[model samples]
Target: MTDTMNAVAYSHALPIDDPTSLEDVTLPVPAVGPHDLLVKVVAVSVNPADVKVRSDMDPDGVPTVLGFDAAGTVAAVGSDVTLYAVGDEVYYAGAMGRSGSNAELQAVDERIVGTKPKSATFAEAAALPLTTLTAWEGLFDKLKLTAESMGTLLVVGGAGGVGSMIIQLLKARTPGIRIVASAGREASQEWVRSLGADEVVRHGEHLTEDVKRVAPEGIDYIYSTNTVGQMDAYIEILNPFGEIVATDNPGLVDLGLFAGKSLSWHSELMFTRSVFTTADMVVQHELLTTVGEMMDAGTIRSTMTSAFSPLNAEQLRLAHASVETGRTLGKVVVTNEPLAS
Candidate 1:
């Protein structure tokens, strides 16, 4: 194994176009903690959090390594690690507190790692963990929507990474729930429709009119991806005692709107459980493993829409730029050249 590896890092906040925004640096392999597994990363995926963190780098501190999702082979395990061993293929979203998966090697908690789906390449598997966890918690834990709940559901921002996964998971598990996804572009509209959205509507233009075109009454649940400001408009079209869930933190929304409709609002942050080290933290591992099984069984498919080779500074910058546009259809992954095949 190599003693030092290449990584993309940033020392200060800068625009994506700035040549110094991201730099290729060599770093020593991190040692595993008592409950950690040392993984040799083969592929990594960029998320909105990666971009946000990179763009908001501290000018005084050390350069921050940014990457959340990774798929790799376990190279070694801490003495306390029992779930995974050397040579096991695993995929996971690294915790936010430590160094991330941007390097050639990463140390992740064994509890959060899961066996990669046999049907997917490392790049494909790398695209899933973060988004899948967020979507799963939002639907199952936050909104409390079960498979038996037979009602109409609305997924806002349906073409993006989290949106795509949410649609697939909901359709696969909750067979009785009807899904209507909102997308503005033609390509996105078709993408969500193909992913099992019973209907697709244009967002930001006429949400109520479009919902009327499909189901005139109102949806039973609304999953807003990043549109907290639009919750008022959606609440107007929600059924009495219905629920609304959002992953984005749009501060200080008017609660009065939901009170009148007898609607409930929920906030879902996938990192909350991990960040707090809650008692149920292992549930993330269970959910990710379940998602892997579902993928291997052909119940759901990888939502990666784009791929880049040789995980490097330039490629990551490009990926970040795409995500910042907020219109990417699905996940964007970057794989080491040796693993891309």
Candidate 2:
């Protein structure tokens, strides 16, 4: 193996349009840890977290690799790694504290990695880990939803990557639960509906009315992707003792909004398990494996909407641009290979 390999990194946070914001450089291939898998990344997907980190991280003049979701093959495994072996195909969302998947090779913990779906292409599989983990953790771990769970779920920004997974996970895991997804555009509305949202409504000013019209009695749960400015609408539509789970930072909001009805709020960050080195961090591997089974069984589908290839600085830049548009239908993937056309 080469001592150094090509990677896309940013030394400073800047707009995506800036040439230096993401640069092609060479860095040492990460060494495998005690429980690590040395993976040759085949493809990667861009997420809002990538955008936020690129714009917010103070790299302090050090080039920082910035990718979270990836699908790859294990080229080597650490001596203590029991979960995977060299030559095994795997997928995972990288830990926040570690170097990311933008590079040709990445060393990630085996506990968080899952077998890539046999039915999925590398680009398609790369789109699953981050969003899938976030949605699963939100619904099962935090929301404590079960197969027998019953209620109307209001998914704010349903056409998004995370929202898309939330809707499908609810459908596959809780068959009786009703899902109402909110989207502002016709295409987005259709997109969410196609993903099994029982009801679709325009977001923004009409949020309450749209939710009320479909749910009538108020929503029992809320999964919001963009929580920054939607607290008021969430407070209005949620039922007494209801719950809200969000994947994004809400910034400053009136916490008292939940007090009125004894409502509860939960924040879901897939990175929490890896970031804190939690005891049950391997749950990500379990859930991702389940998702892969579901994929092979045709119960769910990949959300990749756009694709770019040959994983490089320019491709990463285009993928980031697609995510920054805030209107990407599903996920935008960058692969090490060309599209089949």
Candidate 3:
């Protein structure tokens, strides 16, 4: 293996349109830790997390690579790693504090990695890791949903990456539950319906009215993917003791608003387990395994909406730009052209 690998990184927190925001560079390939797998990254997907890190975190002019999701083949395994070996196909969202998947090679913990679905291409599988993990954790873990769950779930921002996954996971995992998604645009509304949403609401001053129109009984659960200026509407339309799980932080929200209904709020962060090295980090592996099996069985599908080839600074910048627009139909993936020696 070459000592150095091609990568894209940000030396400053600048706007996506700025030419210096992301740059092409060469760095030494990361060393594999005992629990780490050295993956030859073939494809990667851009999440809002990547865009946030690029626009909000300054590295003091140091190059900070920012990619969360990856699909690749294991080039080597550390001594203590038993989950995979050389040449095993894998996909994962790497930990937050460590280097990410923007490189041609990356070292990620095996407990958080999963075997890629046999039916998917590298790009398709790459799109699944970050958004899939986020949606799964929000629905099953945060909302405490199960196969027997029955009631209505309102998914805010259902046309985005996490929302698309949330709609599909609810359908696959809890068939008895009905899903209502919010989308402002006609195309986005159709997009969520194709993914299994039973009803679609518009996001506006009339948001609560639309929810009331679709499910007059009130929402039993809410997965709030975008909660800017809409928490009041949620409280008004949610049933007593209903649960709401959010992935976005929409500034300072009044916590006391839910007291009237005795409602609860929960937040989901997919990076929590790996960043803290929790004992249940293996849960990510298991859940991802389940998702892979579901994909292979044709029960669920990939969310990839756009693709780019020959991984480099130019292609990566384009991917980040698309994600920042907040209008992407689903996930966007970029494939690596073979790295030069």
- Computed on alpha carbons, the lDDT of every model, listed in order, comes to 0.87, 0.91, 0.91
Q: Candidate 1 on 89-135: residue-level lDDT in tens? A: 99999897888898888999887888889888999999999999989
After superposing candidate 3 on the true structure, give the runs of residues whose Cα lies further than 4 Å from its correct spot: 337-341
Q: Could you give me the TM-score of model 1 versus the true structure?
A: 0.96
The C-alpha TM-scores of every prediction are: 0.96, 0.97, 0.97
* Per-residue lDDT of candidate 2, residues 1-341 (tens digit): 98998999999989999989999999998988899999999999999889989988869899999999999999989989988888999999989889999999999999899899999998999999999999998899888999999989998889999989999999998997999999988999999989999999888889888888888989999998878778888888888999999887889877787898999989988988998999998988888888998999999999998999889999888889888988898899999978889
RMSD of 2: 1.1
Error of 3 at 91 (Å): 0.5
Q: What are the runs in model 2 whose C-alpha is more than 4 Å off?
A: none
Residue-level lDDT for 155 in candidate 2: 88
Q: Which ten residues in a row have the lowest lDDT in candidate 3?
A: 332-341
Error of 1 at 78 (Å): 1.3
Clash totals in order? 0, 0, 0
